[model samples]
Target: MTATMRAVVLREPGPVENLTIEELPVPEPPPGWVRIKVRAFGLNRSELHTRLGLAEGVTFPRVPGIECVGTVDADPSGELVPGQQVAAILGGMGRTFDGGYAEYTVVPRTQIIPFRSDLPWEVLGAVPETLQTAYGSLTVGLDLRAGQSLLIRGGTSALGVVTAVLAKQMGATVLATTRREDRTAALAEIGVDHPIVDTGTVAEQVRRIVPEGVDAALELVGTPTLPDTLAATRVHGTVCFAGMLSNQWIVRDFYPIGYIPTGVRLTGYSGTSGNLPPEVLQDYLDKLADGRIEVPAPTVYALDDIRRAHADMESDQVIGKIVILPISGQR
Candidate 1:
């Protein structure tokens, strides 16, 4: 008989209250898949957006975690040993398929990346989605180079901060912007060279540092802030749109010919298995293990308090990622 486990289930796209901790049947992985006994998982704004029906193509009665850290509980492929530690994400997790918002998540073998880390579950859980997105947007979308100047339009965001830290590691001069002046010091702590407060004229502040503007800009604030991000870039520089923190997706009044500067390139990136494959997840894990880059300790919550967790994330009060430990009583 199949066992049952604790899972945070979203019955519909409505409110945080829609997500409930329930006893669900343990999933048996299909052929070429494995069952992972989830230790921890990180939460994202995308998941929040999905719960509110903002994300398209998400079906109801869904599990909402996009990434997880756990052990291979059952691997029929014979490639992985039982109890082997691993991390899994991407491949339509929590979107098109059952995901990691549970005590056990059944994911495809192809999506699993063998990882061994001594770090606590919160830190490991925080690394997968954020690091994969940041790494892809920087290396794949922007192709960031050493000595170049980078402007992170939404620098105070979790992805923005991770990207800034990684860019600094790659020898880039990073300039960051935040709507709140209070976040300036925090941004600076993560190696942002210039933490400017944006007051409708972020380009002006950016131009103050580099007369022609920075070499590249990553637009994490979405279409509402895309113009300013583009304006903050040098003539030949690139601007990548990776997030929609402004909660705006389409440009209402778009004039591509006029809005786009001469010789400047605009690119949009979304992280997925095709763009951020499982092997890349392993690469990021290796980096974390070796201290090449670090993910901050996540603000943790019990799986039972998931409703409060969603409220906290939507409040925009928390700075870093929030983690969910399915085993609520354990530390």
Candidate 2:
């Protein structure tokens, strides 16, 4: 192992230019922690929030990545053998400590999920966090059942596309939203039955299709569209707040009666590594390998292109997940 590795460090929150690459010492794992030789990591809106100074509890000089896939480099506890494929996700990653924006990163054993896959690093990089959130939202947040109807508020997002895929696999009818008319094709390819253009308010459009509204709705766009999302659900149906792609999550001056409609339930989903059972991830990967499902095609970037990646994510011009391959030649 090299004594030093390349890492993108955010000295302080400001702009994409704040993300600068520097050679830093390879982090050594402490007793219960494991060091991973990072292959690739995904660019998430959460990391973008941190970089824009919008995220809470984040300190400066951080390597801001919430999810990564790689090989185990060192494990003092011997729970995992060296060179074993593993993934680490959001348990204070990129906030409380340095995260996966580097050649190597050290995370607590609990945050690690081990798996085996011959898939390329880019595809593997897009799975861990995306699958965890989508699967958790569907199962835990909404308790989605087969034949139920679903609406995704931000269908063009990586999370939205993955959720749609999972929902379809579970035998649900899906209605997803994208602000751009052109991106509707992307949603339709994933089996989304209805792709409604999000003209800031989509409840009317959603009702036009489902009439009584969808059986469930996933709110990825945040609080601004949350009210409309709630209105888009049928009685006794659920709306789960999962992502904050809009970066404005809080809803002030609380009033439940006027806010929530009769017999409708509102819930939120934020998952930990444990929320995603290993078998679930392995099953999804196996399905992917055999062509049972597809992840939204990712927009790939090399480590040197971190700034441009962040810029693209912030711009919202890109349709799917933005993935960064810190290691060269992983493609």
Candidate 3:
């Protein structure tokens, strides 16, 4: 009999109930790949899309986790020693191949970033995908720099919080916005220079604060908000769409030729290997270990409770990252 491992499998792409714990064969790393003993992994909106059949070219009965932090159990190429600690994210992980929702997962050795960190499982697991998106959107998409002004269009979302922290750490003045007026106070505590209650007038509110608009904006909320994010940037500034928390992927009537202002660049950072660079994850981990940066503590669940975790994420109240620890009891 083949060796087996427990994984949260998506037998069919439908509702959250379709995700169930199943005993799956332990996967082996093919040539150029490495196998990891998944200690902890973070859930993202992309995985939800994969589960809903919204991710094109994705087949059913998949293991849907986009990223993880774990120990490299085997590396066939001898690039990384056995038992090496590593973090990996977004190299078609949960989309084209089995992913970290299992006790073990395999990826190309190039997908792994071997790192040394003493942080606990929940924290490490929570950082990879979140930090990758934030780092990529700010550094690459927005060309972020010190002394600039930034607007995070979805201040209460997980990505928004991390982006504010990182952009602040980089010496940028941050103005964050949320649909609820109450969350702005919380944003202020996290170094947000100004927080706007995201009424229908996000651009108008931001202009009141920064006058000429911000240097850049990170749009976490989807289509309904991207236009406003673009309008909130200064001439020649950029806007990067990094997440779709609104759950809407398409922007109807999007005529960029006329809609996007001249000299105001529009870019995006998908959480792919190209966006989530390995050195970027390493750099974030190093800062995490040294106390220079912080991520909200993860709300952990055993692999058994994976369904409930997803249900909660779909709700309006998930304040931080939700993590699954396979070694812990099933949810």
Candidate 4:
């Protein structure tokens, strides 16, 4: 391979205008890492936040991507061979370290999960972050069991859809909420039993649907709906705060004393805590292969169209994960 390859780099912390295509040196695999010829990388909302200087601890002139699907080019040990399809989930990629927004990337071997040949590249890129986060939060954080009820905030989000699908497959009743009423049917088709349009009365509607209240809630939207989530949760129910899409990471004005009266519990979920093990990832991949869970492909863009891809993601115009193809390829 050539010493240099094309990549989208964030020269400064700013808008999409700050991102530009450049020929950067190809990275080599470290001891426990593998170098991948990235076919596609998924664009995440956090990437945009990092670009806007909202994400804490990110550095300048970085490649911004967290999830990737590619083929192993070089493995220092015999653990993996060249041309094998793989995917990864880690914080440094696109933030503190060079990410998959390039022609090639270096990922830790432990972080890399192999994908079946039957799975498409775009779908592979979309799987790691969303699926791992959902599975970890639902299974590890909440201990969701069969026949239980689940409430997912931001039902239209990629993570939300994955959570709903996984929960339904595990025999749970899922109730989801979205800001757009038109998206309710789409969410319902994804196995959500109750899809609530986010009017001012979301809490009231959820209470009416499950008068006893939901068994658990997977909260992706932050403070804007925290109160509603609390109100909809059943006595002794649990709420997993997974994401802060509303940009409200800190909750200073709340007392759990009120929730104690209702016997409710609130816990934060983060996927990086080793909650999503290789076995669980393999299970999700197997489900994908067996046609059990389907993750929809978002709009595909070329490497040069990085700005347009970010714009589409930030505007919420896209239905699913946005994929960026570094090399020319079809859907």
TM-score of each: 0.94, 0.99, 0.94, 0.94
Candidate 4 segments exceeding 4 Å error: 258-261
lDDT score at residue 89, model 3, on the 0-100 scale: 84
Order of candidate numbers by lDDT, starting with the best:
2, 1, 3, 4
Model number with the top TM-score: 2
Model 3 off-target regions past 4 Å? 274-279, 329-331
**Model 2, residue pairs in steric clash:** none
lDDT of each: 0.85, 0.93, 0.84, 0.82
Query: How would you encode candidate 3's per-residue C-alpha lDDT over 122-161 as one tens digit per residue?
Result: 7888888888788888888898999999999888777888
What lDDT does model 1 reach?
0.85
Q: Give the clash count for model 3.
A: 3
- lDDT tens digits, residues 241-315, model 1? 998876777987778889898889999888664565666666666777787766455789989889998898887
Worst 10 residues of 1 by lDDT: 272-281
RMSD of 2: 0.8
> Which candidate, 2 or 3, has the higher lDDT?
2
